[model samples]
Target: MNTETGVTAQTRPSATSSEGPDAHSAPPTRGQMWRHLGPGIVVAATGVGAGDLVATLIAGSRFGYALLWAAVVGCIVKIALSEGSARYHLATGSTILAGWRSLGKWTSWYFGVYVIIWGFIYGATAMSATALPLTALFPELPLRAWAIIAGIFGFVFVWFNRYETFEIVMKILVGLMFIIMVGLAFLVAPSLPDMARGMTFELPEGSLFYTLGLIGGVGGTITTAAYGYWTQAKGWRGMPWFPMMRVDNALAYIVTGIFVIAMLIVGAELLYSAGIALEDSDKGLLGLSGVLEERFGATIATLFLVGFAATSLSSLLGVWQGMSLFFSDWWYQLRGASEGGHEGSGAYKFYLAWLTFPPMILLFADRPFLLVIIYGAFGALFMPFLAVTLLMLNNSERVPAHARNGVVANLTLAGSAILFVVLAVQQVARLLS
Candidate 1:
């Protein structure tokens, strides 16, 4: 029978059948389909935040399909990492923060400090990204005004909806984003030779930044840790749910991987061929849209902008909700508060406000140089944090031996950790210089 996690259901035989209880049965109902398809969508929606889209588009424009290999590598890393997080929850029935607490106080403190700073900086970034498309669509409204509106709208969406409703909305937005953006990829014919070469596993000259960026952007983010929370939200608890969770995480990142590859194709075929350079900011997307209009038509350009808006705004909503959950859970643990009753408590609303309002200040003034440095530096550190943590946590005694990392997983995690440390060192050195 189909389960709540939206994985492909395997059949189990009825009691009367000689084939055994885990054999064939009738197919699952449509209702079961909706129930099972949740955590993947939540994780996917969170992973594709605006910064990721910008990074992917830029990588495509610069290196064409040469960096598509990085995107594929990124997807594999995220799946490995996310599966580790979800598996921890299903195996131990504890939140990742709680699991970290089990390890030591230092773990808790590290996460606390990281989350607060990350949320503050990310709030401003997400708001600004969301506002860019709105400003372009209706130039009558200033960018700052649109940013406030987007923030408030995100706040309200998270403030009222339960987890299920939130997932539904996110899935719809993700659907629209996939159709419009990925559709453009097919319309622009790609070079089979170049795409094949990209898959050959060789890095091109002076392409380190682009390669590292694709690796970093492939659905890696702070919200990744929040996968445990989404797992809980979907009522996926205990080892019995582990298979479904694996399927959910895999399918989500696979979709993300395909979406990213499509964007790279668009970059290879359209921007790189035309000698167009994408701007460094969200406005760069607008410039790209204009290019699409010139090459295609206004209809295609407007659709691309709409897809951009959906991607950015959906990410804002997800970060606001997911991080808020992460923060509130951390606060409750620190205060020795009771569990299972904090869902929509004051702590949750407090973080929701934290993500929505204060950062708006940056929209008016120049995003302070020091703040940018701190954000970029710490942001660069998070993927490694996730990679290393998954290695430690999943391989620990707490995890069942059966569920622990194999040699393949260990090597992949180690590679990802090393890659991020290199990127972080480079980012920090750049900032200091």
Candidate 2:
């Protein structure tokens, strides 16, 4: 029960309240589980922003189907991380922040510093990303103006609404983006034999970085850690919800895999075959739109732009709502508050505003050099931190024996840690250079 709102499951509590139905009843059957898949949809749509699509698309253009296996591998790795976090939540009945607190103060220091710096940098990043397609589609407004509008709209939307409304809107955006992207893929008519060959793991020369990137970049972000919070907001609690949670996660990533493969197909068939090299940024999608217009006429190109906007806005909304939950939980837990911060809480709104307004400055001016370095340094280490901590938390007595990591889970988590560590090193090296 939420003490502030006096909300109970019987009262149909708003998502802003954070308390879900207690796990006193039996779990839903498989037949009934489909409808309970909101959290996964939220995570999937949130994770695959424009940057992720760009990375996969670049890989497809460079290597054709050779690195297709990397995209599939990326989905599997994220499943391990997300499942571990969600399992800790269900098994121990604690937020991930609580789990981190148990490990040591180091976790707190790392996360506290990380989230602040991350939110500031990411706010501008998300806004600019969402604005790119919009600016392309509507040339009357400048990019900076569209960026501010996107940020404000995201802030207002998440601020006023509850998680249920948020989830419904995300579902619609996901369906819109997914259908258009996949439709473009089939319209290009990808070669089955080449894609099949790409399924076998082979890294081409000079492609090591791209291969690692494709493996690491697909739908992996801070939002991945927010999965448990989404599940909690969805009213799932305890071990009884495990089967439903697993289905929710697996299906979501499976869709992510398909969505990624579609982008790769577009890259291979549309860009690579035409010998076109796109600028390597969010604007790359805009460049792709020009190519689309030339070949498939203005209607298809306009549809792609709409899909691009949907993709970017979905990510902005997810981060605004989801990451704020993370910040809220972190803040309250730091104060040793018994009741966790939920959607409508002061801490939640603070982070939401922090993500929305402050970043708008970057849209008008250049990013500060020191801030970029700091952001990169902190951001690079987060995945490794998540992977390593999940290993320690879930394998320890914090989780019940049955919920502990098995051999496969252990291997996958360990591999993820190593992969992230290597990526972190590469990022730091690039920043320093």
222-319: candidate 2 lDDT, tens digit per residue? 78899999988887878889999999999989989999999999999998887899877788899999999999999999999999999999999999
Query: How many Å off is the CA of 151 in candidate 1?
Result: 0.8
Itemize residue pairs with steric clashes in candidate 1: 4-36, 5-36, 6-36, 13-23
**Total clashes in model 1, counting residue pairs 3 or more apart in sequence or in different chains:** 4
TM-score of 2: 0.94
At residue 289, candidate 1 shows an lDDT of 88
* Candidate 2 Cα misplacement greater than 4 A, ranges: 1-26, 338-340, 367-377
Evaluate residue 95 in candidate 2 and report its C-alpha lDDT on the 0 to 100 scale.
72
- TM-score against truth, every candidate: 0.90, 0.94
User: Which sections of candidate 1 miss by over 4 Å?
Assistant: 1-35, 339-341, 367-370
